[model samples]
Target: MFCYQCEQTMRSDVQDGCYTDKGVCGKTAETSDLQDILIYQVKGIAQYAQLARGLGVVDVAVDDFIQFAIFTTLTNVNFTSARFVSLVQQAAEVRNSIKDKYLAAALLKGVEAEVPMGPAQFDPAADMDNILKQESVAIVNKDHDIIGEDANGLKMLILYGMKGVCAYSHHARMLGYRQDDIDAEIERILTYLTSNPTDIEDLLNQALSAGHLNLKVMDLLDRANNETFGNQEPTQVRVTPVAGKCLLVSGHDLHDMHQILEQTKDMGINVYTHGEMLPAHAYPGLKKYPHLAGNYGGAWQDQQREFAEFPGPIVLTSNCIIEPAKNYRQRIFTTGPVGWPGVRHIEGGNYKPLIQAAKALPGFKADEEEKTITTGFGHHTVLGVADKVIDAVKSGAIKHFFMIGGCDGAKPGRNYYTELAEKTPDDTIMMTLGCNKFRFNKEEFGDIGGIPRLLDMGQCNDAFSAIKVATELANAFECGVNDLPLSLMVSWFEQKATAVLLALLAAGVKGIHLGPSLPPYLTSNLLAVLVERFDIRVNGTAEADLEKALGHAVA
Candidate 1:
């Protein structure tokens, strides 16, 4: 098995991926191979789905399956090989159904339907062993020798970015949001990928197109969240534990969080948000629940210690779930595309089993003193104070805007984000989103007159909020977004962050500082293209990068 889709992927002079028996994320080779097979099948589905759309026949179910199947392949999302096997089989069935539809629609139109070869006609092996042997079709870097490293890297950029798009689209769909144009773009890109095209310019354009597609998906998700849960408002969330039976809900699914809150309401369960779910407390509709407790832990990387130490059951609602330790494995539950081999999965929005486990365990022995952090500085809330922010900027009370946040990870260089945020001048406002904010959100940055110096914009997907805020600020200043005093210091860990990065680039936002390290899939040639065209910079030392952004050394 081979995988290099996340920041934690193996890298060295000789090897750049986890091709061994197990990955750094604890994913077994068998699981990795199965995920590859599933992805290949999804491409087959897209091949036909793209054609069927051209014939004016669209299947919402096919679109949903494509989104879900790709989301499952994201880093740390699913590690259950059995689940992938089923998904691979289901993908073939979906592909066939779509293939037939495309043919019939062309017949009705009395036009010849051009059926593509390769993945469009792929037939899954009958058994898991044979299926695993289909690595020739499933490998991510297949035909790199023919396409060369640069083209392969660009392909990976588009594929990984598409994964992020699907993940966000899946979340929006759960919230009852659907956009056919977005679906068509998804099919178009995936179908394009099947041909293994090597044209450098076309590949680069398609990669940027993925970023543009993600921008739309992010906007849809933003609307779905705001309309369904009410716009986010600035609220201080308790970080300390409360005394009672409790349940910790991690991951980024607000819909699942709401369901858990509803099912366990008034049942003596204190529901606490963890990781990306921390933003749940800022939504008026969700926070209205009396027992909707506060945040419990930092980010996803620290979950092993946090989940083990906690006395109640833990529920993972989305991606970035590592393998569960034995002690808490029985008490932990997976939902909505997240899985581990033995962990119980809660299906159909049911929480009875998870609630039962929470009741059986001992919750916090006693209430801890109140500790808080502010969140919910989404676009709506930030724009609500636009006049005050604009005035402060014009008056020279706020100098520069540093958007320093993205997916956080366990890597050593991650401390760069913390150091940069900590060292920002008092005159600069820092806006952050995703788990990377955990690196400094607990610290005090004071305020710029009436505006909080630090603005916590929701989850990773809330990059939409950050982008919206930047555009509004640019409009206020009567200049381009890049012309505004905003520097995006992105710390990426997974595909969702990749998608966000692409969105930023697609919007012509330049000079982004991206690190802990560049993706292994990025060949030096592709990196050079980004650097020359977009002025993208690999992250340097916190002091040096910060000085470059501020144009002066911090005191």
Candidate 2:
């Protein structure tokens, strides 16, 4: 149950995590232990898969499974013990399948196969109780005292960063995209973890490399989303509910949302986007459906209250799920990698039962007065109007570009982002993604040179879109991104955001402001390295940070 993987993790002298009964996110010790064990088994699969890959023998199924299995373990993704228990066995089965292929390849080459000890060559119990008992050997802090906290912290960063990569890679694979190099890196890091290496320099370098892979996965995922759903365009979505049977879909999976939208189109049920799905409204294909209503609620952390009020069924397509409140537990459905104990799971992308539940429930009583929020300012929408942005900068209409983006959490310091967004000068524009924007998105900024000052570039999963737009803007101006009038004010919450931060670090992007509290897994030594090397800063007050970001912009 010892988990410090998210921004909401407990921290104190005697308690660095939720090792007691349940985590702050409501994950039980049983489920947490099973997640750790499942990760261990996945590493075992990687141990064999990497060897087989060397012989030019690769299994797409194994690579795909690796991504999916890791996605399930990410914070707020899955809380069901049975899901993890099933995945543990599934990971072992995948490992054995890969092991046989590795051995056969070695025999053909006349090289004796050597499957290492540890996760690679281990047996698991048949049930959940025994699986939890075996967690002692598989904990991330196994040598925290002996190897020192700094080394353990670096390893955890690598592990967590790799987990983010797995989640992103899985999203890309769902849209028929997966790279062999990405697969190799996934296995490379997993195999390294089996040894628990402690060299600080090696660990740090590997972490940066993991960041690079995360960048690749994000790139792949961006293409997958655009290719599948069509490039996002500017669209104003109605914030108020329309009268009808309704299903509110949350999370980062567009593929699932598309399927659900298609299946429920003529059923007289209205589907509204929640959380990360807000940007889905801008896609031409998704917005074509008249029943695809606008966004509802705030970020993931507020779901407990928000979900209870929504008049109909809700479907979570991916991570950032809270423990279901009993009020609407039966009406809630989990799809994709998202899971909750008693919540119904819509396997194989089926939404029939969910549609039925929505029909049976009392939806919004009547259409309310229209309230609208503009979204879908993704990379394409912003880049398509590049000349206007460049001209605005040249004409001195824009002083700086602030990317106030990242995963949102319910922690106290998170208010800094809301205030920062509110305090940005009218001459500057702010871009947002993930759930963080919910803080200040409703606050109007009007437009500059016909461009909205506050741009919503899809979800936190669309960090690539933000990165791509920045790089292209820099290119258009013939300057390094650092020399451009841009400052990345990132707020991180979970492993996916961690992976995004790593990508920025790996790309040598500097002078970025990151906060809402630093990760607990980063020891002071590692934090010092990031500060010194990357010039990353902790966020202060909104006024102070805004003045600082504006002051740093290159005119």
Candidate 3:
């Protein structure tokens, strides 16, 4: 198996990938192989889905399934091999169903159907072993020498970027939001992947175009979250457990969290948020639940220790799920796109088994001293204080702005983010989003007059919020977003963040500082294009980057 879609991908001057029995993200060979087959078939489905769209036969279900299937294949989302195998077969069936629909529609129009000769016309193997045999020609680098490393790397940029697009779109779709333009664009990009293009420069341009497409996906997701939950408001959430039967909901699926909260209401159980679900407390619709307790744990990486110590059933609703540990193995649950080998998966929006597991376990014998952290300072919350923010900057009360947001990882240099946030001057304001805030969210940064120095935007999908905020700020100042007194110090670990970065570049938001490590899939030449075109740079020490952000020249 070959994969290099995350911050932890194996990299060096000479090589940039993970081609082994296991990936750094803990994905096993069997699961990775099945994921590739699923992607291949998804592309085959798209080959027909795109044509179906052109023949006046639009299938919204097919489009949603395409996004959902690609979302399942993202890093650290689904690790169950059997599930992927099933998805592969389902993909082909969906493709055939759509193909038939398109042809029938064409015939009814008194016109003949034109069938494509590639994936649209091919038959996939029914079993796993023969499916593995197809990998020789389907792998990302199958034509590496012919296209060279640079072109191959650019292709990966588009492929992985779209995976992120699919991930965000899937979350939005779950909440009943989707645009045909965005859906068709995602299908179009996947169709491009099936052809195996080789022009280095052309592929690079397409990658940037993907950045443009990702902007729309993020915008759709932002609207879905805000319109569904009401805008986030500044709220203090308790971290210490309340005395009661406890159920911990992790990952970032707010829809699942709401459903669980609804089912478990008045059941003598206390629902607590973990990891990315911490932001749920800020949303008015979600926060209205009386039983929805406070947050627990730090970030996704700390789950091994935190989950083992928790005294109740833990439900992972989305990505960033690790293999379940023995301490709480039976009590652990998976839902939505997240999966594990032996853990129970709750489907059809049922919470009985999970609620029963919570009742069976001994939860929090005694309440710890209550600890509170401030969150919910998303676009709505921040912009509500726009007058104060503008005055602070106009009066030189707030000297500069820093956007230290993106996905989090367990990599070594991750501590750089913690240090960078901690060392920011009292005069600077920090706008943070995603799980990366786990690094420094616990700390008290006080406030700049009335505004908190550190503002917690929602999750990774809130990149849309960040972009809106920056654009508005720019307009307020009569300048470009890049001209604002703001700096982007982004920490990315996976494809969703990759898609967000592309959105930033597409919007002409420049001088981005990206790290804890560069994507291994980017060849040096491709990196040069990003550096020159976007003014992108790998992160240096927190001390050095901090100085740059503050306008202090360092020798």
Candidate 4:
């Protein structure tokens, strides 16, 4: 198996991906192959779904399945080969059902519906062994020889961007938000990939289109969260653990977090947010639960150590789950798109099993002293004070704005973000989101006047908030976003970050400094295109990049 979709992918001078029995994330070759096959089947579903939509027939179930299947294939989301096998079979069934709908609609219209070739018409084998042998068609690099590396790289970009789209869309759908137009566009992009187009310009444009699509999905999710849980406000969240029975809920699902908070209410089990769920504390609806305790640990990469040390049950609500260690394996539970071979999974939003596990385990021995950090400076809160911010900018009280955040990983060189945040001038305001904030969030940057210098904007999806704030600031300054004294230093990990990068480019934001390393899938030619078009820069030393953004030599 071969995979290089994440920042942690194995890389060397001679090799660019994980080509062995297991990947850096502990995903085995069999699991990787199964995920590939599942995606191929989802492509088949998209083939039919796109045609059906063209005939004025839309199946929400098919669209939902498309989002879910793609989301599960995201790095570190699901590593269960058996689960992927089931998903592959389920995808085929969903595709056939949609195919029947399309055929019936075409028959009613008295039009000949031509069947699409490639994945659209391809059939999978009955068993996992036979399925694994179908790598010729399922492998990501299958077209590397025929299409050349550059075009293949662009195709992978589009595919990975779509994965990010589906991940965001899945979260919105879970919150009971549905948009037919968004669903149609998702199918359109997936169907476009079935053709194996190699035109460099068109592939890049389509990749950017995925970015635009992601912007819409992010906006939908933002609205979903705000409308459901109330708009986020500035709130102080305790980062230290509290005493009593507790359950640590991680990942980026607010709905899951809310469910756990509700079910475990008054049950003597304290629910603590971890990882991306750190933003949940700012939501009024969720924070209303007194039993919703503080956060535990940092980002996803450090979970193995953190989870083992935490003295309560752990619940994974979404992506970024690693293989569980024996220390907490029995006490941890997986839900939503996250899964592991032996970990118990919570189905249908049920929390009884998870709550029981928490009850059975010994929680924290005693309550730790209250130590807190600030979050929830989303677009709404920031823009609400637009006048003050603009005034500060005019008076030179706020010299610049640095948006330094993205997915965090266990790789080296990530300390660049910490140092970058630290070196940001005292007069500048730092806006951050995603798990990457764990790097420098604890460090005190104080505030510029009344506004905090370091602002924690929600999760990775909340990159939408940054984009909105930038656009608003541009409008206030009567200039383009790039013309403002702002810089985007993005550290990407998986497909979600890819989608976010595309969105920034699609929005015409330029001069983004991206690292720890460029994607291995991107050939130098493709990288050249991005640099020439978008002014994208590989991150240098934190001090060097900070000086470049500030246009000065630091003392």
Top lDDT: which candidate number? 1
Q: Runs in model 3 with CA error above 4 Å?
A: 12-14, 553-555
- The 10-residue segment of model 1 with minimum total lDDT is 135-144
Query: Which structure is stronger by TM-score: 1 or 2?
Result: 1
Candidate 1 lDDT over residue span 1-555, tens digit each: 889999999999997999999999999999999898888888888988988898899999999999999999999999998898889899999998999999999999999999788888889888888988887788887778888988988898999999999999999999999999999999999989998899999999999999999999999999999999999999999999999999999999999988999999889999999999999998999999999889999999999999999999999989889989888888899999999998999999989999999899999989999999999999999999899999999999999999998989998999999999988999999999899899889999999887999999988978899999999999989999989988999988899999999999999999999998999999888899999999999999999998898888878
Each model's TM-score?
0.99, 0.98, 0.97, 0.99
- The C-alpha stretches of model 1 lying farther than 4 A from their native spots are none
Model 4 TM-score is: 0.99
Clash count for candidate 4 is 0
TM-score winner, 3 or 4: 4
Minimal lDDT window, size 10, model 3:
115-124
lDDT per residue for candidate 3 within 330-405, as digits (tens), equals 8899998888898889998999999999999998888889999988888877777888999999999999999999
Q: Can you list the residue pairs that collide in candidate 4?
A: none
What's the CA RMSD for each of the models? Answer: 0.8, 1.7, 1.6, 0.8
> Tens-digit lDDT track for model 2 on 1-555?
789888888999875766778999989989888888888888888888988988878999998888899999999999999988888888888988999998999999998788677889877899988878899877777779978999999888988999899998888887788898999989998899888788999998999999899989899998888888899888999989988889999988888888989999788999998988898898888899999987889888899899999999999988989989999898899988889988889888778899889989999989988989888888888889899999999999998889999988877888888888877878889898788898888888988988889998878788888889989998999988899889899998889988999999887799989887889988888889989989989888787777787774322
On the 0 to 100 scale, the lDDT of residue 121 in model 3 is: 59
